[model samples]
Target: MKAFSHERAPDGKNEWLTPPEIVQALGPFDLDPCAPINRPWPTAARHFTAEDNGLIKPWEGRVWLNPPYGQETIKWMRRMREHRNGIALIFARTETRTFHECVWGVADAILWIRGRLTFFNVDGTRPKSTGGAPSVLIAYGRENAGRLHLCGLQGRITPA
Candidate 1:
């Protein structure tokens, strides 16, 4: 159970990379507006770092977002809702306000990943521990919803 908790560094960082398999399954995206340089997967043709302030940039084109998982996640979720053309990987905390506002009713489709996924570290290595919480992949547009339908991932697909 300890492993399930996304332990933060002393600096309040819960930055974990999405598994490459999940990336490959759902994408072929255009931009990873929130990717750190050390991320394991090549999320898109263009990516932005923390310094780039992806929230300020136009999230144009097919996007793949695995935004920081902290208090700032709400900002990223707001950005995604604005972009309206991408896939987002996030914790399936249905009771959270972000889920209710940003994901539950707004997303065109949602795939509740069956179990807790093991996220990678900045070094591209799998973390020794698996997350305690389950995950979700939200499709922001109809095209992405279609992609989710055909992505071959195990989950329940709910369309809005």
Candidate 2:
């Protein structure tokens, strides 16, 4: 799959965004904001940005969200709930009570991948796994439902 759109890291030295860096910053996700609208993927399937929550409004279509891995993840989770027509890639923070209450509780489908995902380099190079944490893909609506079979992540099924 393609990567998401991102500027250099806050330090301004990286120059580009990579999937692994994004996974480090966000989690195992596949959204690339810098992707051209007419790319073969049809639409943007993933977004990797710390500003994802604060900068954008509700969207309609296949969406990917790898938001910040911070306390404010809850806010982004809330927005994911609001636009229930896409997929969201998030970290499985088993230790956090808020993630359990806000994300797991509201997601339509969850995918617990078997291993840590390797996000790509800004130039599309693969990076080593950043952590041992598990990742998840939370599906929300019908279109997103069809993609679950394609992705094959394990999680309990719930009605939307």
**lDDT, each prediction:** 0.83, 0.49
Candidate 1: where are CA atoms >4 Å away?
1-4, 7-12
Per-residue CA lDDT of model 1 for 1-160, tens digit only, reads 4543675622235667888889899889999998875665588988998888888987779999988876788889988998899999988878777897799779999998987788877777776677667889999989999999999989898874
- Give model 1's TM-score versus the native structure: 0.91
Model 2: lowest-lDDT 10 consecutive positions: 1-10
Quote the positional error of residue 106 for candidate 2 in Å: 1.5
lDDT of 2 by residue, 34-136 (tens): 3322222222445433354333644545456554444545666677677675665666665665467655556666666566555434444444434334566
Measured against the true structure, the TM-scores of the candidates, in listed sequence, are 0.91, 0.59
lDDT of 1 at 37: 58
Instruction: Give candidate 1's total backbone clashes.
Output: 1
